[model samples]
Target: MSDFVARRPIWSLVILVAVALLLWLVFSVWTPGMEAAFGRKRVFLSALFNGITLGALYFLVASGFTLIFGLMRNVNLAHGSLYLFGGYLGYSIGELTGSWLVALLVAFVVVGLVGVLMQVFLFRWMEGQDLRQTLVTIGLSIIFADLLLWSYGGDTFQVTTPDWLSGPVTLPLAVALRSNGEAVLMTYPLVRIAILVGAIVLGVLMWLALNRTRVGMLVRAGVDDRDMLSATGVRVQLVFVMVFAFGAGLAGLAGVVGGTFQSLQPGEDTRILLSSLVVVIVGGMGSIPGAAVGALIVGLAEQFGSVYMPTYAVMLTFVIMVVVLAIRPQGLAARR
Candidate 1:
């Protein structure tokens, strides 16, 4: 942190100011004049929390993408299809069993198994062949999308938010001051907050698994020099398969998360795939911290842009991408 401040004091100062401003905006009670100028605090706070939780959702999907496409450097274009498939399957399972947790577990296992199959049959021999992997996955994505459309149709579906997490909870932050000198606290969907907490915990666990464990060491070593690691008698193929399964499982888990809060539809796969791609590219491929930062930025940009500049909201993401590419193409948290 000190190194960063020393190297780029101006940027550090700018960031500090921005954070301070955001904190003030979040905590301060808005007067009529302030509300008239910048809109209501409730709307702003809602957008802020929405952005945060949405970012958490994006991180879940992109973390898996980071593992496969980012860390392993295998382009799995069918990833989004995996997500949509998981959601549909989870929803079906939830309907049949009336157990959301069971549906989540089943989705993870089933989708992880699918990933293992893809690894064994499709990707095993094509290790260094990016073009082949890309083409095959693209074809697979199309096939998966068609299959899902046939099975589920184009109707929108949302997983039943479990009874435990169904309602809105009031936050401590004041949205406005009542005439009685009381603060009006903001109320948000409890499920979103729960998901955000889950995402954070999951992210920390994943980071620890990848960075602090022996298996993680092997995974990293294999990525850096597969031949050398294989020469070390590390059962590289098995590790690869396990990695694929885990990555795909994470995508499946994220599907359940999305289905809980957001509706699932036909073109949802494409949108999610694009979002994951943007997050990965923006955060720097293969870095978990990068994924988090990238997800947060993209989420906030989308939410705040829609709130403040609806007409250009879609363009804002691409613009951020362009600016990042021009300034720091490696991404904010990616290693130099």
Candidate 2:
């Protein structure tokens, strides 16, 4: 018998599918009303939509985090502050201009600039000093949280979804039925679909830019070896700043969408930051697909867990992370 054989990507995908089917089967038995509830088709579709939208938001936030960690090798504890700040900025801008497009653009630019400034002023000095940088970012996160609390109060604020997206719109997947002898229907939010589509397009574009573009080539080279890239005449410092700014910009975009999709509040900074950190760890530092996959699992797990076991919802994330780490200390998709 051959000791080694070439394995195709399809094999991995098949395994994944098999595992998913098995999980569904197990849940069907262990959790009553699950499969039946989902069998309604509308509820299942709704959950699928929710998962996709949530996953997109996670990817937007985690991509930049993965990027920065890949390039600068920093944990960026303050990324959540950037997210909160971006949400606040977007809200303010939208209120002033009454245009979601303008608000989104302004938010991205403003947050990206902040990222650039941080790189120039604080991170530049702290390069190669991971501990000091980590502490500084932690302090910054605390300051930002406190400032937001003082300025915005602890109340959660919902962003204004554009008029077109404000109300529940009829969707193809929506199903109508009778509830307790009364007519009822399941509806899908148009905005959620938009978020899912936007996230997918952005993810694809990002993948292309990172893998195909000249700047992306430099970035990849830098990731493999900053020293060698620098020695070979690439301006590694400049790349670092650009990558940092890009990552921060993505986080800002996530914040804006998150604000509208859910709500923004003072303490959300920590929550999102922690979630992003967990995502990075489970996905493996610096892995894009890993981040996406990990984020989907974390997001869906939390969402579903909240419905099933509210008390365990919070711990479920950390628990999963711990188990994944225990099994593959480097993470699920860790390349190294």
Q: TM per model?
A: 0.97, 0.87
What overall lDDT goes with each candidate model?
A: 0.90, 0.81
Which residue ranges in model 1 land beyond 4 Å of their true spot? none
Best by TM-score: 1
Q: Candidate 2, overall lDDT?
A: 0.81
Candidate 1's residue-wise lDDT over 1-336, tens digit each? 899899999999999999999999888777788899878888889889999999999999998888787545798999999999899989999999998899899999999999999999989988878888999999999999999999999899999888988999998999877789988889999999999999999999988998899999998888677789999999988998998999898889889889999989999999999988888888988888889999999899899999999999878988998888889999877876
Candidate 1 positional error at 194, Å:
0.4
**Global lDDT for candidate 1?**
0.90
lDDT of 2 by residue, 255-315 (tens): 8899998999987888888998998889898988888888888887777666657799889
| lDDT measured at residue 154 in model 2 versus the true structure, 0 to 100 | 79
Task: Itemize residue pairs with steric clashes in candidate 1.
Answer: none
Look at candidate 1 and tell me the lDDT of residue 212. Answer: 98
Error of 1 at 23 (Å): 1.3
